[model samples]
Target: MDDVVQAQTGTPPVRGAEIAVDGLAKHYGSLKAVDEFAINIRSGEFLALLGPSGSGKSTILMMLAGFEVPTAGRILIDGVDCTRLPPQKRNIGMVFQHYSLFPHMTVADNVAFPLKMRGVGRTERRRRAAEALKVVRLDGYGARMPSQLSGGQRQRVALARAIVYEPRLLLMDEPLSALDKNLREEMQLEIKRLHHELGITVVFVTHDQGEALTMADRVAILRGGKLQQLSPARELYERPANLFAAGFIGEMNMIPAQWDGAALTLGTGERMVPPTGAVVGTVGQGAVTLAIRPERLTVCDPVTPDALQATLREVVYAGAGTLLIAALPDGTEIRARVASASLPPALTEGETIGLSCPPEAMLVYGEEAAA
Candidate 1:
């Protein structure tokens, strides 16, 4: 934990100089792009802003990076009001999905641009450029142009350029989206390693849940221009704030229901007790929504009396797992994934089976159960 924070500490430590966005709001004509956005980013924390497209995740990032101006609210970095600060004066580093490297310059020249702009001597600039390249593990490729490298390598060069000057905060926008899956995963690890090595505060924005989960020390989820939840990966996964968050962050089976204090009784007469201390709204008595991840559900072969009966709808081989689609007796469809090696025996469409889910794995929400 110390190592994590140390690696993200800026070149000149800004002690207690955290970022605070208070009551941030932005609009475009009649559409509210961001509303009442607020987040406190610690000086050396690796934080991620995650949401679906058009969910205003990137807009908030742009606002923080000085690319977009908020219509309302204030932004403070290290307790300094920087809401109106120009991008160049912010002393922030940024990289984006497009690999915004200088196509005309060699990798070394590109990396040295920031140091040179900051008036470093020629020798020191070249030395820092070499070190940055080495940090990205691309030392010998300094002579290559952006076109000479693969997508991942080009992004690394972009990263090196962003960090060569050791800015106080680093912003990345979908930096790995252009790479192939394997390369993306490799670069994700590399970014995490670099973040650990540099200790520069990072504000990462991405729509990829896996990327957010793998990299961020904490994640802030956005939806409809509002923050839905901000928490550690495990907490966000285990306890989403609402139906939108629960459904968006991962695969879930949402069932409609009527809340009766302790248990939710479905229209089909099925009842589910939530995990202890789970918060279900008071207005949820008439109608409520319940969510359960696919992996938490099990198929019972012997047709147990209490198990919900479902008909196997489809089976798909998903490399590491077999995905099964089942519909309950009342036409409620649910998806579940069983380990591929443990694929059920010859289950076919239309075969009736029973399924069971532990109470602890269920999540209930919404005013009326969602169908």
Candidate 2:
């Protein structure tokens, strides 16, 4: 595949084109499917559009792919306005959740379909088709029909077909959602590798936070037809912009508190300081939500200052760690994940425990934050 692409295009196969979406929006009557969504996708960057259902991630993707026209705004590919172009004229490729391979076509023919439509010569199409199959590690399976392949292999075929033309941009809409957990994980790595090898700008949409965090160079989180935040996985996880972003990315223990200049006062009379140099412009206005991740907390003897006293209500033993769910003196519940080796051997439900975390590990957000 690399050889064929290089031979024909006179450029390395692993480079990508840039894309920009400006104030993109879609409307269904009075309902806004996507509103004022905008972002720049760097060349060769893998970006994920992540959000819950009806958040407009898919609607934005559809607009970009030309499947759905934006009610307003424009889409640019490598600085060219492609907003009004048809899907085929955009020189973009797409893969859907359902592996849309034609059951009647053999694998090679399936991959060659796009080239055939584009008027490539028969000889070149066959060569490129075979090379594409090999690129996906499906070299000798070209003669096999779609029904003869596994779900994952069929998806690879779909991918091969999408990429055989070496599209400048690739749009994948929940392509891995159909597979079981293990296979889904396996394909995640495969897709990541393919992105690196091909260097094609990719815009992927999914509701799975884990997938977005694991695969994307940057993730754009959306809700209520608005973008909540766009950042790298680590930053999005460790320093979320607001309460909604904090709670949506991963499991967080959100405790209601009142912020003073130096610290937060929990309802139970416990004072917790924010990490040094942490921004708190919104913390002083009114009530705030102090967010802490489960792994950042430690369960210990109730003798330390800055620790909250709680009663363990449940102990969940995950394979790698134990999760302790506890209720604070004010009746607020919190969770902590302790490694199996460090958990107290005799820990029991209803036992008193102290939960502590460094002040720097806390995220404070204003009360009016919305999803």
For 1-371, candidate 1 gives per-residue lDDT tens digits of: 12223444544333323799999999999999999999899877999999989889888989888999999999998778889898888878899989877889999999999888889998988888887788788979988888989988898999989988777788999988889999999999999888777667898999999899999999998888989889998888888777777888889888777777778787678776667656534344567777889998777863675566788889888888888898876788988877887766678888887778877787777653121
TM-score of 2: 0.96
Output the worst ten-in-a-row residue range by lDDT, candidate 1.
1-10
1-371: candidate 2 lDDT, tens digit per residue: 55435633555656677999999999999999999999999998999999999999999999999999999999999999999899999989899999989899999999999999999999989988998887777989989999999989999999999999988789999999999999899999988978876778899999999999999999999998999999999998898877788889889998888877677789898776677756433555557887889999997788778787999999999878999999989999999998988887798899899988887887777766643
Clashing pairs in 2: none
TM-score of each predicted structure versus truth = 0.92, 0.96
Worst 10 residues of 2 by lDDT: 1-10
